[model samples]
Target: MRESASWLAPGRVNLIGEHTDYNDGFVLPLAIEFGCRATVSPGPEGMLRFTSAQEPDPVEVPVADLAPGAVPGWAAYPAGVLWALGVDLPGLTVAVDSDVPLGAGLSSSAALTCSVGGAANDLLELGLSPRELVAATRKAENDFVGAPTGGMDQLASMLGEAGSVLFCDMRTLDVRPVPFGLDAEGLALLVVDSRAPHRHADGEYAARRRSCEQAASTLGLRALRDVVDLDEALAKLAAEPDGEVLVKRARHIVTENARVTDVVALLDAGKVREIGPALTASHASMRDDFEITVPEVDVLVEALLAAGAYGARMTGGGFGGCVIALLDQNAVDDAARAAVAAATAHGFATPRTFTTSPAAGAHSVGAHHAG
Candidate 1:
């Protein structure tokens, strides 16, 4: 309990894939510049001390008491990481600060969990690889936090390189890097935070996932990811009583996975602009078929497109979050103004707009400045 350290983990934005990760589908995501930073030091015996710039009070828990749902609220994210790692962290103090917008589908929870987990990895010398660390973090969220998100967030946060898009295959854990030079290409990635927070533990997310699972089971497959002939699968679903809902869900996952492949290929060809249609199509599938996007998300997408973005789509778990726009760099200001005006006019919270480029994954900020 002597060594102390600081660690950082970047938040992530899924460029094309949505609701597909849990279905064991492919995903294309990149780490954002915004993320969480943690300062950790040894705590008193048998306890982990936790504090956050975002939270008002300090949370303290016995190191041996780490368990699922034991540490409620935001603290459970980090605690779950410790528990999943099977490490006996008797005493550690965590101080978190983040610029990543929570509830905006930017994988802030993953950022927080990985930041603390990375710090613990460094201080404890766990010697886990990027994939292993993310797997532990994923278990923390799934089993400990009880949120059924797939491994994309953690993987992207752990393995993403600056200026690169991570083309990840959820079924295989294969990560392929695609260079992202949007800024240099005279384009900007605009994130319009609709500010309508989404909680993954909510019934809606779990229900959608369950629907996909049932569809996969009904189709005699392990997951929807196995369905190669989507049209044939759609025809098969048409005969079931509640098949329409399941079909829509399956359709979104299948098509979204396809979009991920398309976007990756386009990026590899240095055809960033061509990826726009895939983004927009992905958004539509999520909206019409998956039924995830809320009004705020939908509106922002429309605004971004109207403002001349090559493509605009919601970028998170939906039901509320941010919409991303791929547009000329010079159009960023106009796009932001348009989103702000549109949201405020519609009686929603004023949207937060910002530009981001792919950034580095988790790393230690070092213990030199640790207080």
Candidate 2:
């Protein structure tokens, strides 16, 4: 192997909290073993170069010319990170590679963005805090990549610790590290990719975002975070014609925020068994209240649960993607087999199944230091 210093940024699995981060609510997410690794060396000149394990060509772009929509496909994500970062400093070069599957709801783009941002900040000696870096990554995704995603994935990728799940308050950027270490005999965390891709460009996600903003605007709140109680807020919304939609949106945020807190407590007490039921409740609310889970994800979760999985729910933005399940280690094979069988029987490609372990956050490898 060649001598290289690299930064590894893990893709994330949001256990329950979904669509809450952008609302300035809460999220429970963990760094997974599968992620993007960028081996960064300081360029003698201002050039940004990248090659992915999944890409056929090495992409090289000038740091000075970094801008939104400047590249296409996987290249656009890293480019957006650079463009966002370049707003604050002089630019450089980079190389990228990863095992994180793209658009499977494992946050591949966010991982790549975090890896590039972390590498650039380290190698260039930029003194940005993790929170600041997260903001930058969010800006990259929202403005450059145009995803309009929440801050969960980028923040989780930037702040994750090995053997831990992160309890993050998106509004305050305060994080509580919850130990998720499972001994060989303990339960397991399994991720099942539905193989049904997610399309952020589709107006559905953007529409949801707009609805959130409209709710905030109607309530005279800067963001949904200002609403201390969803019931109270819904009562107030009763005067409006769109009260039902706003109520549902508020319901998802409030209930999801509460779930994150509950899950944190469960993990803190080593009550690993309790997480499954919470996952189930969350998926129910997401399906019935939030209406984000598609039939494919519903089938996968149902199949996993039916096979005696501890608990399973659709993960990510939910129109299509993956589901995170908590299962007894012994039952993993059965759960995965059931999920794959269900997807195949439904005429979907057999879902990809794998186990997840907590991984380290972004940091410098060869010649760089943490920014």
Candidate 3:
């Protein structure tokens, strides 16, 4: 007996406001054209099997056996989704195919989790709302997969609208839509894959989260998102003997949150050109204060800007990944070539580049009736 269904989820690119999610800050991200698709079918109640076009071996496990580190590599992603969803079945099988390049900082993991979770919601008839789906997928990544990422990726993949950016509040999980007509406005969003990989479950990401938590506790505030007075809060934190790095990290969140709002407003007003400085400022803050951008990322930004991009910044979880650039549609190719040349000149990967437009949110593409 075969009861088959398929679902799809898109990868996301954060235009601004990086590293602020765990601190309960705002982020502006959009689903791109690349995505992951999962095909699922019913099997026994407690058994599960997984396969990916990207992976060589199929991962077989029982629902009850899913746990932190119980699965490894890319398979852990969908495994974690199943664990977090509490999916206990007699048997089930899934096959995944993706255009979302792995380790590109483009939220490929979230795409995988969302596609699987969304399909499960329909296949199992769970009836979860989009917001509930976001939480569930995020939990899968955070707890089951052992990634300490925030909810932005899941939310963007689930709730993203074509031609719009998602304005998400991490604290409330509230969402507001901002129009993104950059393409119609003769602009293009370039995603440069610098090809540097960083693990969110590792010490660097967790250490940064701890820093923000410490800053929030010390300032008597709920999260960095709650800080009202930036200068005053910085002065207060800078006064402590052991608070210099904390002060820097806190400042990035405090200011980065505000930058999200500003960028959204500009985008709403059809003033996309003016948003350039904010993007550059964000890169500077992340590079200087937050200390997340690497030389490769900085080079990406510099190269994009040098090629006449209106703005550019690193777009994912710091240590290393991808960078996003805003430029005239006509300039996209030159900018991309410049970035590759720049990366190559510095003894780095040649760099992969592409232009992306906002894409629709996760949805079902096909299903086969239960047998």
Clash totals for all models, in order?
Answer: 0, 3, 9
Q: Lowest-lDDT window of 10 residues in candidate 3?
A: 196-205
Give the TM-score of each candidate: 0.96, 0.90, 0.96
Q: What C-alpha lDDT does candidate 3 achieve relative to the native structure?
A: 0.88
Q: Rate the local accuracy (lDDT) of all candidates.
A: 0.88, 0.80, 0.88
Tens-digit lDDT string for candidate 2 (234-324): 8887667988887887777777878888989988888878888889989998898778888789999899899887788988887898998
Candidate 2 or 3, higher lDDT? 3
Model 3 TM:
0.96
Candidate 2 TM-score, C-alpha based = 0.90
- Tell me how far the alpha carbon of residue 115 in candidate 2 is from the true structure, in angstroms, after superposition: 1.4
**Local error of candidate 1 at 345, Å?**
2.8
The reply for model 3, stretches above 4 Å from the true place, is 199-201
- The positional error of residue 37 in candidate 1, measured at the CA in angstroms, is 1.1
Q: In model 1, which regions exceed 4 Å deviation? A: 197-201, 368-371
| Alpha-carbon shift of residue 171 in model 2 (angstroms) | 0.5
lDDT of each residue in 1-371, candidate 3, tens digit only: 33787899999999898988888899999999999999888866787899999889998887778688888788888877777776555477888999998888899998999999888777777788888888889999888877788899999999999999999999898988799898679999999999876644267777888889999998999998999988888888988776899899999999999999999989889898889999999999999998888889999999999999888999888888899999999999899999999999999877899999889999999888854
